[model samples]
Target: MRLLLATAAAAALFAAPALAQDPGHDMPMPAQPQPTSDMAGMSGMRSMMSAALGDYAINREASGTSWQPDASPHAGLHLMQGPWMVMVHATIDGVYDWQQGPRGGDKAFVSGMLMAMAKREVGDRGTVQLRAMLSPEPFMGKSGFPELLQTGETANGVTPLVDRQHPHDLFMELSGAYAYRLARQDSLFVYAGLPGEPAFGPPAFMHRLSIMDSPEAPITHHWLDSTHISMGVVTAGYIHRNWKLEVSRFRGREPDQHRFDIEAPKLDSTAARISWNPSANWALQASWADQKSPEQLEPDENIRRWSASAIYTVPFGHGGYWSTTAAWGRRTSAHGDLDGYALESAVRPNLDWTIFARAERVASDELALPPGAHGPAVTVGKVSVGAVRDFSLTPHWSFGVGGLYAINFVPGALRASYGRSEPQGAMGFVRFKLD
Candidate 1:
């Protein structure tokens, strides 16, 4: 208990200085007029606003255009100016699993995110941005699944159960960048910072909303959430008036492991991507990534690794869009493989209503057991579907509600260790914006 208290005190001491710094402090600047361009319609309006807002207040300045969507008032205050704008955001999520033991105990997962972002405009050219996020890893309620424990084992064996109630996965990051105009209609932008991993596709449904998070075992299977600080660089180029190319490198530790023991050499990541917009209403994108061990255990060996992915998006008719992504990866030297896919579509027949649906699948290879153990390799599959409704309660505020159903499949021993088979579950949330 004394140790725990000491640790808490140390963390508080470290964070106190940062909290003392005023979050709303900003440099004063003279007002400026918006820019102008030859392009007609929405494009011209955006160009004008981009010039007027300069770099620091683009997102908000752009909101002034009549055709553009209103800015999110809930996004919080801007902390900086110039070609860069800094802001903060907070979010909360709740999850419930209907599949429990014969006793029919339901489970609950709750999480939160506190993040700061910096966006820089590369002058009149383009923009760059970085973001840092802090949050608790995923955690489940005590009344959750009990069958996963052997007769003698207890919930204490599951770290998230205890860590969640307190605070365990304390995480933070800093990153963001912008683009520069290279030609009449072309621009180049680069960004580096802590971000999500590009893993499983649509069917896997492993990464619900957390873009940089992993959707594997301890995370998806055991219900433990993990976050890591990663440094990354991304370069994007616009060409042919309709195509965009992107490539990036991320260097950082892996997620969900003991920090001190983590091996830094093994922490390297790379990604390449391309996107094409045939028309104002139609666009497509594809990307790939190579990720090494985030935690370098044996600087020489025992490093986790993997590479894989494919994605595409298409729009049909007015306000209707469809997207699909697939990926396959293997952990070097480990008996782990990941294969998954996802498909989704959304349509807005009118201004008041929107409809969307998604389906996904994920599978993993078996891990080689240690000496004397009797168990087959591990494999898992999951699926989920849901819909969201956005209602304009007021000119400045919009509300939304959503629900989802998820299913989990696992072999015996793996199921026993990770509570592999979770029945269907659901979630809901509300959002507000200021502008």
Candidate 2:
């Protein structure tokens, strides 16, 4: 029944609005000739909503390539009418894995997403956009998918998540924004979402091409981009050419165990981010958030978190690119403060081979323990690499089988019971995508 309701909601969302926006209406416009200056007045809003601008309105790459390195790689379906454009972005990632660790489990599951965005001219110098995103994760079981030492959120009702990535809720975002042009290169906007992300962290790791091939969440997910699923958010921003500044009010709490339900929205937290693209090949961002009780088990705590990252992408042979990212994150709380750092890269040297690697140093408190003892804060380092060869069966379908290997540098306190500082994991997968 839950699945049914979710499916209905998605269908309704997609169908209803699209019909209302159909350009088939018989209404005719009564127009008078406008001066060239007046036509030029709306350039700012047009630049933001124009298809010629590639699909990203917010981040412009370093050298101004149509491909925005910071934006997620996507296969889109689009429609352009008079002064409006509508689009859909979707993907799914799944894998089979085997791993050795205190908090690791082997399994097969997919992480999938469907997002839609629609924009239209609001007035002479104004534009409005609506965005909706959804995911289905409940069928994967209660304990959640595997990772060496990821921890955050809750699962199976009231149980704190430890060393595993929790399932995303059915609805990830349902938001809207209004933008007004201030000048040829300037725009101001206000955004609100029931369940939306704030201006913090690198675009969710899952969306970064540098590590898109990796199925596991980064071990340092909580320290950086956990708020990508915040239940309520409102953001205000200013965009001028290749730079943007944004501040947000959002619910700090991560989603609870019920992946099928939309939790209540709370505006108990705040965050700010500033990003710039010096050239089309590079994008840099820095952000901070003051959050309250983001984790259920750590209810009394408040977290002041900071993150920064540099992302670079250079287009190459056959719809491929070399993408890389380096990021740092820190979280300060009453009990202690910890830091996390990550570097990763992905390259498709040729049409047939896709390769990627990542290294991370994470601070963990949830798994810092001995057989019969509790230990101090500990930091662990993890590294992984993988490759896939494409065998195309059709233009939109292909078969891919890949392998990955990961090793961990366990802290001394955990070395005793965990046996050795090194625990290993590997995975194999078959993938599908739109061309």
lDDT of each: 0.35, 0.68
How do the residues 1-435 of candidate 1 rate in per-residue lDDT, one tens digit apiece?
233233323322232111111122221121222324343333422332342212222322111110011120113233223333344444444434343333224445545555555544445566554454554442442223322211111123233221012222334344444556666556555544444322211112222221211111222321111222333333333344555465555553343333212223222556555554454333344444454543333223232333233333333343233434333433443434444444344443433444544444434332213211323434555555555555665432345555555454545755443444553333443333221
Error (Å) of candidate 2 at residue 337 is: 1.3
Relative to the true structure, candidate 2 reaches a TM of 0.82
Summarize candidate 2's per-residue lDDT along 1-435 as a digit string, tens digits: 233234434433342221111121111111112225665435433433352222343323211111234332333444333344555555566678777855556899877676666666776677776777777566676667877666777676566666577777778777777878787668887878878788888877766778876776788788877787788898888877778788999999888887777788889999998887777677888999999888776678889999999888776544566889899999888767889999999987765678999999977667754211224678888899999877766433456667788887887777765567898888787765433
TM-score of 1: 0.54
Q: Which pairs clash in the backbone of model 2? A: 61-279, 61-280, 62-279, 62-280, 63-279, 63-280, 64-280
Top TM-score model: 2
TM-score of each candidate structure, all chains considered together: 0.54, 0.82
